[model samples]
Target: MGIRMIHHICIQTEKYTESLDFYTRILGFEVVSETANFHNREYNTWLKIGDFMIELQTPKAGDKFNVWSSLNGGPVHMGFLVDSVEEEYERIVELGYKDFKVKNGKIVYEVEGESLFKIKAPEGTEIEIRDTDIK
Candidate 1:
């Protein structure tokens, strides 16, 4: 159990501008990262309050689940902070869990230099295991 904390929660939204304003202006969350046309989405933004974060993503061009067709809002995934991503990935493999995101023959992937891996929960929520020691 190297997990340190619940890192962040992701929210998928069609009202990107409105949600961004609500989180930043109304709720007073500060933007940590903001990228346009990220992963084929209109915007991918990260807002934070102290150590915890909220990831807001606009609907992708071809979302398999039709995320926007329903209510157009809700959580998509959650990230957990870990002491060491490599150790956690190894532990997960040793525990016999077979489904997780992999890149270039490695289970751990890097996003903006942060090491992490994503796995789907039983009800289809994505869970990101991430290393907390960011340089």
Candidate 2:
């Protein structure tokens, strides 16, 4: 069987509201669908803007994973394909998001092809901005 495109990417966050704002406002992701628990609290949310679909989910009260813990040392990080890495990088910075690509307020020049940048999500997840259309 041939491989199809990625249907969605699931992101687990502790601060749901902040994460929602970061994705929708900072990155311009649109909420296409959502699922809430018995108390009408969001348990899972599907956000999309183009062919890309991102699912934001939060762990239960008795869940094992502690979302607040700093797991920044982990190598697992999600990447999003943007139209222009430089432009997206600037926009993310303007939105008061941390630019992990910058050093001491100086912007380093990136190579021509296969470029990428990083922006920290509200939940401390590294949201990568990649300059490629391959999904």
Top lDDT model: 2
Cα lDDT tens digits, model 2, 1-135, are 886887887787877899899989998999987788823334789899788888888777656555543454664677777778888877877878764745345452344556676667877776667777664
lDDT of 2 at 95: 78
- Model 1 per-residue lDDT tens digits across residues 1-135: 799998887877776776676556533479999999998998899999778888888779876444332234755555667788888777766755666766788778888878898765332346688876545
Clashes of each: 0, 0
Worst 10 residues of 2 by lDDT: 102-111
CA lDDT of every candidate? 0.71, 0.74
Residue 25, candidate 2: Cα error in Å is 0.7
lDDT of 1: 0.71
Clashing pairs in 1: none
